[model samples]
Target: MKIGDLSLPEILKKTTATQGLCFDVGAFSIRLRSTHKNFIHTFHKLYRDFPVITDDQLIDFHIDMVIANNYRRWIKPQIIARIDGQQPFQAFAATHAMPLFEWALNWSIARLGQHYLMLHAAVLERHGKALILPALPGSGKSTLSAALAQRGWRFLSDEFCLVQPIHGQIVPIPRPTPLKNESIAVIRNFDARVFIGPLFEKTRKGTLGHLRAPTASVDCLKQTAAPAWIVFPQYQNQAEVLLEPLSKSAAFLKLASNSFNYTLLGATSFNLVKTIITNCDCYNLSYSNLDDVIAQLDVLSDNAQ
Candidate 1:
């Protein structure tokens, strides 16, 4: 479907003063009406407001969500996400929708042909260079990015990092971070200013909601951040902070594995990764304390100068 050409569905809610808020989900402008009476209903209304993104020449895949009875998600296709219960959809959708939107929109716009690759990595900008966190799921990449965004570093994305191959650089596409379970509370405790939405319950990934990314972060999309550092962060149960350097080859493999379209991008991806890993530094950072990690990152950033 032509997302730009698509229009939003009309919303029906008693308490809503307005029909909804128009959101640009890639090419699709999703309009959501907040009922206030039911937050989940508001999200659902927002979702279906736009025309269904069909499987076509431009769209590689199709995705939709089904919320049945407000208590259970009875049926949902592989493409359709069923985010039931009192959890945040941001976290649940980030792993799937975030990258998919990037692919679909990029393809529609034909911005980088089929060569652009996306990854589920958190990117932050300090000075002019970008710090790519190509870490595993359990890592506190989201938390660290959120804290940095709240402070000074421009938030490119909380869950996915878009890499430009020809230029051998990272681009910013700021969006909200989905904080699950304890992580939500952890972020809330650290800063009450966090904009957390309501949660859906009993989903496969547990309850969910999202912490909004900074608006200032999204405004710096034109500026390309040099790949100054690549750190694989790990969040252990109760471990002291450690920032050990990893072998360049190992880091390369790990980064390639985390990438969305590395295999498809072929030589372009290889050259980009080679250039990034060769000149930039790589490290393995593990921490249970955010303040400690933040402080250490400050020192590391300063040393880079």
Candidate 2:
């Protein structure tokens, strides 16, 4: 029920309650466990939150991992992750939990995670339709996603749109999209609904935390959203918010490049992407304003419907 009450492994596994990842983090308790004990715990002291119910679960998937490493040779471990703190009780999410979560996401999408497949994308939904935002790190995809969600769209994921190959639709992996630097302030200033997670003091990626996704998005985990639009987002200075028409060919190329598992599926992956781009309205959106982008997307959806 709460982070401190449940054991570490139980917390992560609780995500199986839906079909996605679960998070049980706070100021006091910081521990994580999956089906294995290969996780590290950096912190050594218990937190003060005790049992305030800072637990989140995502039970929307079946995972698969292709683990290869020197450690595997000895005991066959599938994943490696950062523990809470040096003392072993404080959970520094980026250093401890997020990495494991990524591997878990990779597993949920497919039963494999070798070097060949990948994507730089985030997922969210409305009604039952899912929107996949595939863009690079600096591309303002997260900003657009957060903005859309606050305005109305269900936030399925800020990053990682898990594509279930057999079903041929994106699997919802709802989690906070990490917002760095000014974007954090931008989101907080933009909307009070946005749940910005605990901010770390200093790290390689600068300060980081999870952007809380709406609970409704996670609740509708079983719904299937047909790929409606494949829009590559870019935030540019001095640029007006506009969605540019993009050819299916260019869209496919860019999307594949952004994918996390394009090469892994080979022809199957190619066909999946082709079907998506073909059926979806493809575009290149450039904007310096969130309001402008949000308004245009709403208008576009209304016209499409």
For residues 23-103, what per-residue lDDT tens digits would candidate 1 score against the true structure?
443322333323222333334332332233322225322223222233222343122232111222232232243322333
Instruction: Please give the range of 10 consecutive residues that has the lowest summed lDDT in model 2.
Output: 40-49
Q: Score every model by TM-score.
A: 0.69, 0.68
- Expressed as tens digits, the lDDT of each residue in 191-298 for candidate 2 is 876666556546456776557656556455455566788788999988998888899999989988987767767987898788888888888989998888888988
lDDT of all predictions, in order shown? 0.60, 0.59
